[model samples]
Target: MDCIAMYIDGQWVESDSGNVTDIVNPANGRVIAQATRGTAADVDNAVAAAKRAFAPGSAWRTLTADDRAALMVKAADLIEARAEKLAVAETNSMGRVYRETRYDDVYAASGAFRYYASLVHELQGKASAENGDMMTVTVREPLGVCAVIAPWNYSMGTTAAGMAPALAAGNPVVVKPSSLAPVATAMMFEALAEAGFPAGSVNLVLGSGGEVGSALAAHPDVAKITFTGGTETGRDIIGRSATSVKRYSMELGGKSPFIMFDDADLDVAVDRLMFGIFLSQGQVCIAGSRLLVQQGVAERVLDMLKERVPKIRIGMPLDPDTEFGPMVSKRHMERVLDYIRLGVEEGARILIGGHRIAEGAFGEGYFVEPTVLVDCTQDMRVVQEEIFGPVLTVQTFADEEEAIRLANGTRYGLAGGVFTSDLGRALRVCSGVNTGIMWANAYLEDTAGMAVSPHRQSGMSVDGGLDGLLEYTVLKQINLKMTPAKSGWFAGME
Candidate 1:
């Protein structure tokens, strides 16, 4: 309730220069509260705190795997107990439907914390094939100080995606939550500390992405940087990491395609398509921005979507009756509007809502009516670029090959889905799509099951499964020579 302050090194501290940024309610252009604006100096302090906590002599370094897991479980419990309040703040800030904040986001964060917590003791090493008396082995070691940069759309969920794994791997973290939704993240950290984490183990800072964010990415002490945001921002961060050659993992921007084949269940596919893009007012990274529908089913699916996308109630997140909320900010909402305009100008047909939803009985808020554009082309900016709003651009495909071509046309490979009754087609499309993850018969859904990125844009690692835990650690190889033999050291011994 109080104006939120940043948490750093087990203490709540305001910005060193007394800078502050107002947290606005996107539903209406109203300043909900003001948080202390973080700066480069703040990043320095947080990074230093993480460094010390990850140092060889620090208390955090000596904790047992069970001890770390215990803390994660405790933090999740605390968040669960306060789910109502946390859900309200998160929904208000990010414009998720109440059911989502109350169930999807909060539950996922809780499950992730527990999932990574369960992985603490699972960091097992392997013994390699040995020759004679010589032996070799590989073990995973902590990456030391980790800097996590989270996005505004799913502030808590994305924060958990990076932080939980790092903490589970025994690495200390310096967290930079998106300034747009700092209050909820600060609250989450407060819960983390309350669960008895050591001092300097977790820290939070708030500010514009370009300022404190760049400092976090480029800091010499930060051993790893995990980021989730726009692709250009990810590119910039990767470039910045060159200064220190730090290890980095990115869940960058996605323009995931939602493909529906002629054989798919029209009712189910249409429902998921509506939910996939319009759930958080279409402000999700994997929003299924490019909806690829087979030619035959296109008209039927479009009819169903036309009714579904608009019927979703657009109002205050706090209202129990409201099903959808506003976008994060007026600027973001305006940009989405501009994109809708561009889509029309580019010859994409407007099938459903495309303009801003004017003030209703509740009055002022940045609400855009759920917009759908059909007759989309692959080269169109609306299909190729990420439109992280509750807007859908539909494209018709002639067959499975055309669908695959249209789906893989975008540069993004974060996520996509295939809706079909034929198992062969489902398997074929799933295998053919150039994406980190592909779901059959579902869209915009996530599970603890992980996927490996075959391509580079989605990154070189995986999350959600056992492979996900590797992002927080490094692989080291050790060799032993029981024979005390040298490999022709003096050109004599062989």
Candidate 2:
């Protein structure tokens, strides 16, 4: 049993309290490995190291932008070399299908680092003339020490999402990965170290949110907190960081809606609709949990989904042919099942697979069959709340206006998509829907240069593009006076 230890000041060390947490393989609920459980004291050590590494005149802070870019590129290269190992670790630890973890998670993480590496050179300030006698110039400076909290669903991706930008901006980061899936994150720390990052420049502290996460949020030395998790937890971090008035960026929960109009190509709609909800077992924050279809085509679409969704392969994550894997844990699976029960009690009709699938083949793993609920109203809990599972609720609308109303009915506004061949209808629906991210004919297509914004209660943060990189920095204005002060204005008072 190899137990992973905390990485601080560029060294692997045991927890100060000697506490440990077990890592379970979601494929079969096996306790595969152990990880040291960090505490407040451990957080303090890592944060102190980050602060020191980010202090003025430190090697990390004094490096030129191009120098930092080169280091980031090197880190990216290291990640590419270890891609296969990282993919296996991620899949084994978190139950993500290898088909996805191998390509999307691993390479996407590497791409994030490389994207920021390229963007580091473009981190330029602005200058403007304030009349002829004075000039105002603005420059972006790195925030001192940043605490980056990663979510379990896409542990490596979210970790890279937060850490890459912070590093590119010359800010040292203290990362606290989710306890449920910290193995790949630890491996990433190893790769970064081998890539020659300065000691203490990038640190990792592994533990539960109540202990390590809270301490990181409230630490006085931390200048910013970047978090990706549930809405309630995001609220807690925001409140905790308020004590120090520390800047924060968060990508939280979403109950995104996928609208299919009568004009949509039925073939494309069916495929995208299924993948939009079922991909990653619907653990994604941007999962299209709500499916709003126009009344004219509702029955046809539901018929296609009902026939296709149940056929999705459900088995171990490592199986090359497995299209869907088990839920992350027994507790999460039960939570989703409970939501299904609630939906039934509220009078929604179950259209497809629903219930736990554990008998001869499941081997006590956390598995839930793909579920669909029809005859759902906008007010139903199943439609408005985030199930965070491979459960889709079908709701029909009479027209475009009704569809827009249904899509915007929820409290969340993270993401939504509109499917229609009519460009005018697509544009209209996309504009009327009140979500941070909107797609006319696609869903969850991401690149480093595009910004991911969450609206309303979904979250408050910047997660992509130049704005994402700029979130790790502070802006300062420099005003120079080229002319002497006017003494005549005060002559009367003198």
Summarize candidate 1's per-residue lDDT along 236-345 as a digit string, tens digits.
88887788878877887788889999989888988888788887888887777788988898888888887777678777787777877788888898999899999989
> Pairs clashing in candidate 1?
27-365, 281-390, 282-389, 282-390
TM-score of 1: 0.95
* CA lDDT, every model vs. true structure: 0.84, 0.89
Itemize residue pairs with steric clashes in candidate 2. Answer: none
* Model 2 misplacement above 4 A: 482-494
TM-score of every model?
0.95, 0.97
Q: What is the C-alpha RMSD of each candidate to the true structure, in Å?
A: 2.1, 1.7
